[model samples]
Target chain A: MTYDWTLWIVFILIGLATTLPRASFIVLGQRATLPEGLQKALRYAPAAALAAIVAPDVVLVGGALEVFNPKLAAAFAAVLATQLSRNPWLPFIVGMGVLWALR
Target chain B: MSPNFREGAREGFRVFLPLSVGLVPWALVTGMTMGGVGFTPLQAMGMNVIVFAGTAQLGTLPLIAAGLPVWLIVVTAFVLNLRFIIFSAALARGFHGVPRAERWLAGHLLTDGVFATCLEKMLSHEDPRWRLGYYLAPSLWSWLLWQVFAFCGVMAAGSIPKGWSLEFMATIALIVLLVPMARLRPMLLAAVTGGTLAVLLRGMPLRLGVIVAIVGGIAAGFAAERWQGKGR
Candidate 1:
């Protein structure tokens, strides 16, 4: 299928939006210090972002909190799988296995 | 090209190889999903080249698939990419002595993983050119491998089974990523706070809840770390 032509505009905007943030402090931080408070808070950005993305999908299934959702089951199982295998692919395989079985 | 570029890139690529193994699936899944949705292979590759952001790209996909407004998708991706700002800030000090053009190149190539790798190099030794080389080196491999595998996934999407729950695997991929980083109390707190709030605020329109959770979690962890006098 052909892409909606408008999607091209959206991509340019997204590309710009994403790139500027990655560039801003690189250019600016050379001249002035980022605010002290923000500098400290930025350290938490990774943990916060990852958690914010994962937690909702894991805990909330079917638009409500259901413990039995395949997602949640697979999520916990994946955690265990990572600890055992220490291989990144292991978790995904186990998680998908659990997801398919539970679903 | 600086004389150090080759050495730096080589070191960066070599060290990043293991992590790339983990990252390969993400790009593959993203490419496949783009095909599963309405995107043509060309469009998917175009987006891959343009976006160069796994998280933001993945985050925007669901919204797009749900038929959300384009503006909302853009905003979501921007908010998701905001973490790169922090990374840029951290990278800035290391890159300050470099040429502006080089800095721009590094900024385009920067990802959290590469940032971390380059930061480790900066910490171990204090050479501005070397640091830049290290940063750009791994980044090249990362960009190349990601695009190649993702393109393959897009081309092969139809052959792949639908019931494999690849998205859940993606989620699990993300979880494995999160676990190791959440080592400290502050980090753990941030993750827990963000995650809890996201689940609680799942109903917020246009997935603003994700933003709320991220900002809220960072604020919480920052406050906690400040209280403990352990902020770094």
Candidate 2:
């Protein structure tokens, strides 16, 4: 297949997309100030965004809710595993293990 | 570097070295997905070298493969990287008199774990040079480790068994990341709000649901915090 030059452009833009936001406050220095309330709210944005990404993946399958699915089960197992151990590898090991066993 | 600067850098690297364990799975997943989804190895690694944000890179893979509009993909990435905006803001608090160019470089090198480590270890250090040295070591180490493992994943993607169900692992990775952040009541509320909304609004075109879910989650969190304050 032929190269799509726009794909390269998209790649470069994605880089800027990450870099600009990260550098926003630093570049602006003290001139720009985030609202106090907004700053508190921003604390939750990352977790919420991550949950938003994950919920659709495990809670719904093929655009429909499947509460009893293996993926969901594995996710719960992963959470439990995380709580039980501080080992960084436990979640992945437990999670994928449960997913594989159930499937 | 001065003796103080070298000592600070050593302490920073030592503190962050243990946490680098968590970076392995994430980096590998990011790289494997990029290559597995049909990008050339060069393109995949190039994306790593440039975008440098694993979550956004992974989040956009499906959209990129689906041939979504360029602007939409870029917007999605910007939203995905919004957390970095907060990170930059919080971390820049101690950088008052640092040169503009150095601040810009520091912001660009920032990563999720490195930010937490820096805040915990060196944010209050009296010397600017020491703090600078402390921040740079871990950030650079994280960056280097990510690039190395991600490159391995990109090269190994072809050999990994197809039945491994790698995509699900990516989801699991995100779940792992989210669990520690959701310990507080307000955070849990935010996650539930964002997640439920994402599911309900999944049909919205162009994956706008993700953005709405994030906003909804943040609002829910803010409201919960306010309510808790009144009860105290």
Candidate 3:
């Protein structure tokens, strides 16, 4: 909160910590070629990573798994709407509507 | 620009425009969070511009507010953003022959949405120029929306209703994004593995659960693919 030199220094360090990993392979280029198997593994990593983030968000309530919660229900509705409509906005709209209504 | 590049850029912008709707709220929330934590307007916006990563920004804010040491906070961000290493590796194929400066710029602009969009749709395209154009359009669009909304959030953080739960939109947005990509059998298997592991490992310190879930999911997907190949 304090506008001080240490805070600013932390800001720069945080920026570097965040950006460098993203640029790692891009800058490494030919120097560090990924093995073919690693490349193959990378293909599935994104979906898995996304699911990893989302699942905890939807299912966890107060650090406990609450299966019957509105968030889970809303998530289910969103998945169904996304599959049926195949429109990007509909799932979000429907899911939020469900959450608001249930709450 | 060549016709191919222009076309790719146009397509990229159009596809990203609708999805950009989902980004605005998340960015605003990030800004509001920085403001709520007592950051000055300039500092909040500076953090947004400098870090350009919502998750890390939000994750570190509590630590900053609690007066934690700078090194620990930076290390936490490094661990939180480790997934980007995998993403850049996956995306390297598209930028194989790109100039060094340009690659650095592209890497800076990358976000979760942009990375997911590119990996799903554009990475397989044969033309590097076209892929670059496609990548840049969404990157720039997202950056613009994020900065502007985040600025507004910092300014108007007090007025926004606390109970609106507007941040829930981010979860809904992610769901919509993931559902389409999980249509494939192996991908679905990977998602299931990842989601289950994440829930099971939620108590892990430093959010290492995400990284572990991702690895488990990828291995599951790889095994599934090999099994299907053998069957065929």
What TM-score would chain B receive for each of the candidates shown? 0.77, 0.85, 0.70
Candidate 3: tens digits of C-alpha lDDT, residues A1-103: 3557567788889999988988988778757766777667667866786687678778888779999998899999988998898455677678878888999
Q: Which ten contiguous residues of candidate 3 chain A have the minimum total lDDT? A: A30-39
lDDT (Cα, 0-100) at B44 in candidate 3: 85
What fraction of correct interface contacts does each candidate retain? 0.74, 0.74, 0.75
lDDT of each: 0.76, 0.82, 0.79
Question: How do the predictions measure up, each by TM-score?
Answer: 0.83, 0.87, 0.67
| Residue-by-residue lDDT tens digits, candidate 2, B110-183 | 78898888885555888877888898889889899899999988888868775766556667667777888889
Model 1 pairs in collision: B9-B137
Docking quality level of the chain pair in candidate 2: medium
Q: How far is candidate 1 from the true structure (C-alpha RMSD, Å)?
A: 3.5
Question: Per-residue alpha-carbon lDDT of model 3 for B127-158, expressed as tens digits?
Answer: 77788889989999999999999998888765
Clashing pairs for model 3 are: none
Off by over 4 Å in 2: A1-5, B1-8, B62-72, B120-123
Which model is ahead, 1 or 3, in terms of TM-score?
A: 1
Docking class of 1: medium
